[model samples]
Target chain A: MIELTVNGATHRVDVDPATPLLYVLRNELALNGAKFGCGMGQCGACTVLVDDRPVFSCLYPVSSTAGRRVRTVEGFGTPEKPGPLQQAFIDRQAVQCGYCIAGMIVRAQALLERVAHPTEQQIREHMNPNLCRCGTHMRILDAIRAVAATGELHRAGEKGPAS
Target chain B: MRWRRTGYVAGAVLLAGVIVFAAIAWQPAIPPVKSPDIAITPELVSKGRTVVALGDCAVCHSPEGHPAFSGGLGLRTPFGVIYTTNITPDVETGIGAWSLDAFMRAMRHGVSRDGHLLYPAFPYIHYTKVTDDDLRAAYAYLMTQPAVHAPAPRNDLPLPLRFRPALAVWNLLYLRPGAAPALDASPRERGRYLVEGLGHCSSCHTALGIIGGESGRYLGGGDVDGWHAPALDVLAHAPRPWTVEQLSAYLTTGLASEHGASAGPMRPVTDNLGDVPPEDVHAIATYLMTIQTSQPPTAPKAGAVADASQLARGHALFDGVCATCHGDGGPMETQLGRPPLAASSALQGPTPRNAIMMVLQGIPWPSHPKPTAYMPAFADNLTDDQIADLVVYLRSTTSQPPWPDVRDEVRRARKDLSHD
Candidate 1:
């Protein structure tokens, strides 16, 4: 049995400790956002955040993720209220059929969390695992930029001071 | 003085440990080295762009309004519908994180980063035929594009079917992941790969069992996008067996000698093929011609009937059910824009699969620009044995060379088209 927090909710599940965290999330917890693609972890279709670091969930076993916070696409906000990256996908019309979107969002969230402002090369270097066959790559960059700009706007509007 | 010196030594040791810890913890995570600057010179870019166009990567990769190279297209096949994924450079969402080696494996080896076999439907089988240099150039061009973060849609195939390891079994039967067959025959045979593989001419040109395996009457057109794909081999009818020059012209411009213009699915092929270097097109033409000529399918034996009464009954059934469109004296030219049955080389081919498929499925009505011809499916009306009797009757009555091997073809076609 392992305890994990996903999307702000805690869950305890009994299963093979060596099962990929992706399977635990999708099959055990019924979180379909994280997918299983090329189970060997080649395709980044099964990416998620473990302790705020992006990892291919297909390769990361549930045992290693015990007591860790796992962030998935569902955690990135819903259709009614989307997170910055989720909104970015929509604004750029980035989700075609959308099987890769969740993984893309999960991976992107890790990058944005660490590097508030990433250059094109930085973004490319960080997220090369996700493969899109539809060829909407340019728009994905624009979507990320849009999200960054929105983040900046929010930061400027915030009231802040160190006590 | 001794006590003060001891304190200093301990402090120095603590400082040294702190420095070592910092060195290990804050190591700069430099990205791996990519293929040394592919001289994206205008000439190189142009070469890469042409290859991109030839491969029609956009047809499978690009979705409407999506950034180019960011994938979202949906391809439906007999097995199931598979959605395209995002191929952008998004650090989190796209392949911006992949090494060049990973990309190469996916393309050439049909293996992904984690080492799962990709389905053949991805056409890596054909792509594997692409040269490393060309693949690199194409990759370079894609790398230059903006990264989209859109995810691919879930493949709705059944459970074990969706399992990646199952592909290991599929690979044994069909996946030969490598370059196209090396042509040792004439230049024409060499071009067959370009036409059949990357050109994907066989995707439409070849008759397939409804489930997507090769049909007996190879290159006798099948159905795509609701249009009938016309037969390409000499064994099938199109008024004339396309000569090398004619096929080359048809492939390049969708025009050929006095018979028909390519439209519908052929439009994209011609539009793309039109831009193909003339030399490549010629090579493809040479290859396509050589394959059929080498095979030289013999016609079924002529003028022999085991039972005269049975032949008469078969002939009577042909006149009633089939002769209106395919009869010897029927006005074949106006109804089907088709060649006369007596004159069809397809009739002389070893098997009557082509004729049977056409008769059963109906010819794609060709419209100029794009064909909107609708051929109604006939399985609801015809039985397996009845279709077989018709096959025997047609070969005996019309085909110059009797089609003796038709029984197996009928069996195969029936099996393939069972769902239809």
Candidate 2:
């Protein structure tokens, strides 16, 4: 049994230790935010936070995050009380198809926590690992910038009463 | 002993090559076929013009920004570029010296007046099937063009190219010079002949082989230059399935009431098609409608949230920016000439790419004087988010499937179009 602390909820997932963290989160815990796109580490659709650092869940083994704090889009915020970053995304209308947004928000959050004020270039470089095939890179960048300007980068994840 | 065996093998190969070369290079005795002696009447010239248009003569032969039929277009081939020859009746430099029999032989057998092998780039394989009556009329029309002094550009291909004997071998393998099978002399058969033969639609629409002959996939759609020539065979997938009437309108006037105005390489083809009789276009369309291309259905809407507010946002955005031009009885669509959005294939189609592209790129004036409609690019002015909302809203109004990840598409489309 693998113990996964996703969005502050402890769950014991009975799967292959080698199973992609994406499958465990989605199938075992019912977290549908991270997607299964290009199952290789190449696409960031399967991204989630491992101890507040962005990692591709598609490649990250379930066993690796046994003790690490894991967070999926569910922990980010609900639609009713969406975190500031999610609200910024709503304000910018950054989500399309929304298959890639969960990963994008998580990665952007990681960058904002470290840099606090990321230039357009820094944002682009930081988010380079994630790809939105539909070409929403510009809007995603704008959403991140909006979130940064409001200084709500850290607080967006604080709500929802500790998952 | 091994070296001796090798020498014998080499000598046998050399002997075979020599025999092949001799056979291919042998000149046939020219039969005295008289040129049509009757004076060219106005009727003959007009009929000949139709034949020329049917063949799309101006597109390949007439070099861009050059005089018509003076032929300096450089057609790319796998081996190298083959420059189109001057077809204008310049006595010294063009087909003026070619007798009627010689011209027919070239059209039928890929042979020149001098008994040299002509390249398949001339499309004689398809031209071989063109009726003699049409051929004669086409010639009568060409003979009327003013003989320009300009000579064709020299073909800058690798050595051992365009040599009479060598090309004959290439022809022997690839060229099946004969008339295409006609089940009956119906209008559909006539359309098939025109589409497959002198019109040589398949030459561009079908993929080419390594030897540079038509792969004969037959309307499977091939690329001409950079733009894609859509498939016409069972693989054809228009946003809205093409009906005979819509195809006829598109072929005759380059505009269909349903969707998509001709662009890129298709512009010249549609323009040329306008010169032909409407009945001819109708016949072509009749034959084309029989082709059934099955494409995979759109992605399921399982993951879609379908929130009412999300749709409302899109509807609001469309009303603000697009309603002025695309609204019901909007000035641009109703009065000016833009196609109606409700009947637009791009909006209702399985994919949002075309509609989104049209919105982002907009319609530009084609080189031809026809259509005269214009839709300016919104890539610079509209925010990606707004375009995403607009595309979704427009699609919803038309009852199209909700496209996922549209903001990314808008962003990428803007980048791609900016480069263009």
Candidate 3:
């Protein structure tokens, strides 16, 4: 059994140590926000935050996440009360297929947390790792830009139930 | 009274020594010549191009984003940094004023047209063996190039080494001027001339002494820019012994299906070799094969079992980090035909330096030509402990014993990274 703290809640799970974190998040913990795209690290569909740093959960072993805080898209907010970044996405309609949005949001959250008001160039460069095949990049950028403009990222989760 | 006489004797001896040294070291400047109006034949220029390619002049003299041969690349040495000189024929800053005789003397004697002793970092010791005809050909090719007026940077050496005349003593110790001994007309002989004279393979592949001369181990392996240049004479001892055909392929394309891709300092070398004629590469390979020292392949030893927790950590790290490309049935192996990690020379080598370097500074994607395999650098992404774990896990898969000094190697590689 290995201890994993996801979204501020701790859980003990029994799984192969080498199994990717994405598998545990989706299967055992039932946090299905992080999806599987390419099993390789190429695609960002399985991105999640390990101690506030975005990593490809599909390629990240669950063993390595022990004692470290892991945050999935579910940690942002519920559908009833979306986080500020999430609401920005909805406001901008930044989804075509929605497969890559969770990763895009998580990656952008990392950038915003590090830089409260990132410039256009900073946002583009920081978000470069996460790919949006649906060509929803412009809308995603607008959504992230909207969140950055308001400086309300800290209030993103205040209304939602704490994990 | 006796001590004062002794001091005077010592002073006189020192003064006499300085005078004698100056007499031996001072080289008279060759009178400057007008840029010659001799019409260079296209055929001669083409032949000169081949000669220049074999010599790998651009690899040193052409800093990236600079015009070809208009040099400003700083070569790091144990003594200090020596910057490459502009070889372009610009009359003001480059070698435009140098006559053919001046050029030949620089090649043969490691002296500049301005009567200063040239640093051995220019590799004139090996160049001294180049035939006069080939040197003339190289000059023809260089003189015809579009001249850029980039002046050479001053070397950052210790105060004593700043005296250019000190190199005259160094030359006396190491320089051997004259053409390479003529040989029967064979591909191997042609390969020898190129390798010894122009290619100067031994300059890197051979170990160096404390004073920076060849240690006489002669292709017994050496380090350059922190990466080990593996011994060429022991190619037979490689995990999969290198054949002439495979070596030729590797020399031309920078990849061998049986061995592995070139990385580190060898990458640019193989890239340059790729542009040369295939026959030249084949001849080089042929010559290299003839020099291989025969040694019986050792039987694989049983490795000591690693600590269970460390093994788990290492395995997990590999699955997460390396498995995307290097795992069994990975995309690189299945689709792209990259060799298994078992076949990698770095993993199978006695030391873990190369493996650590490869992980920290992954094979960068080449800009020109068709792209080959590319691995992203993990220097910032992975910690020193994490890299050591990965290296240990990879070593466990092979028949070789675990590198006991993996942590040290990782730290060394990190230091090398910062130095770069």
Interface RMSD of every predicted model, in angstroms: 27.5, 20.3, 3.2
Better of 2 and 3 by TM-score: 3
For candidate 1, the per-residue lDDT at B67 reads 70
Q: Considering only chain B, report the TM-score of model 2.
A: 0.74
- Per-prediction DockQ: 0.01, 0.01, 0.25
RMSD in Å for model 1: 23.4
Worst 10 residues of 2 chain A by lDDT: A154-163
Query: What are the per-residue Cα lDDT tens digits for candidate 2 across B184-281?
Result: 87778878888878788888778877777777566775655434465676424555667888888888776776665665457678888988888888
lDDT of 1: 0.62
- Location of the lowest summed lDDT over 10 successive residues in candidate 2 chain B: B296-305
Clashing pairs in 3: none
- Sort by lDDT, best first: what order? 3, 2, 1
Clashes of 1: 57
The stretch of ten residues in a row with the least summed lDDT in candidate 3 chain B is B296-305
What fraction of the correct interface contacts does each predicted structure contain?
0.00, 0.00, 0.37
